[model samples]
Target: MAYTIDRHPGPDAPRLGAMVLHPIAESVPRARRWFQKFIAPYNPACSVDDCALMISELVTNAIVYGRSDDPWVVRVEWFREGASLRVEVHNPGFPASVRVRRPDANDAHGRGLLLVDSIADSWHSGPSPFGGTVVSFVMADAWPS
Candidate 1:
């Protein structure tokens, strides 16, 4: 079994795997729309939807926390690693050690990663060798939610 990982993908980079990059902003729903369009042609059923939400949460954090007008980058990269699908989002955020903390019970936010951590079969956030932090999640579908 071999695992293939591609960087900067398109028709020129090969089509076996799909990738999409968008400029991130404060509007999470808008960002998610790009994810939806990017995955729509390739993914059927609800897998893409779930993947979009995962992307939304990551991009939302990037836009809200990055606080930079240097044209933030939002990339959704995925490929099959054995039987599981791995998804990663890259942005120009400082690759510092970050911990998603739970706020007060009534807080309206700060729960996005919780949802992601809960839903993803295996998930983590770490520094990308290229730049910034990358939030990567792997879904096996067989893993208990």
Candidate 2:
């Protein structure tokens, strides 16, 4: 699938970046790499490793649970909000259906959201104005103050 990356900045505006990806298992790694590269300039302040891990889980959840009959694409967007970085994943799923699950120690799956909740400074899932569900998380002090 063809992917589009947008990096537009203004003098007094926040730095913004976005990408569109095919909703497939392969896209999870792609999303993680994209997020790491996009936030590289911000460096150690952002916790690139943690951010990448969270993005991986979020994208995986979108691919596995957000699937629908329609040709819906996964949209990932990030922007600097003051000293924090906010990342959002948009998919064609109901926001109410997105929840954190407590899997048993023997389970091999279903720990994605738990990782996200633990790592993100703040996170939320809600209906998107763009016509789908949006799962977003923020990393505090991601940018120099």
Give per-residue lDDT, candidate 1, residue 42.
47
Q: How far is candidate 2 from the true structure (C-alpha RMSD, Å)?
A: 2.2
Q: Give me the runs in candidate 1 sitting further than 4 Å from their true place.
A: 1-27, 40-46, 67-70, 142-145
Q: For candidate 2, lDDT tens digit of each residue in 1-145?
A: 5254655565453546677889888888888887777677656386888988988888888888785777888888887877888888988888898999999999999999999999999999999766779999998887677
lDDT of every predicted structure (CA atoms): 0.62, 0.82
- How much lDDT does candidate 1 score? 0.62
Best by TM-score: 2
Q: Residue 100 of candidate 1: its Cα lDDT?
A: 70
Residues 68-135, candidate 1, lDDT per residue (tens digit)?
46655555566555456677766667767455778899998898788788778888778775577777
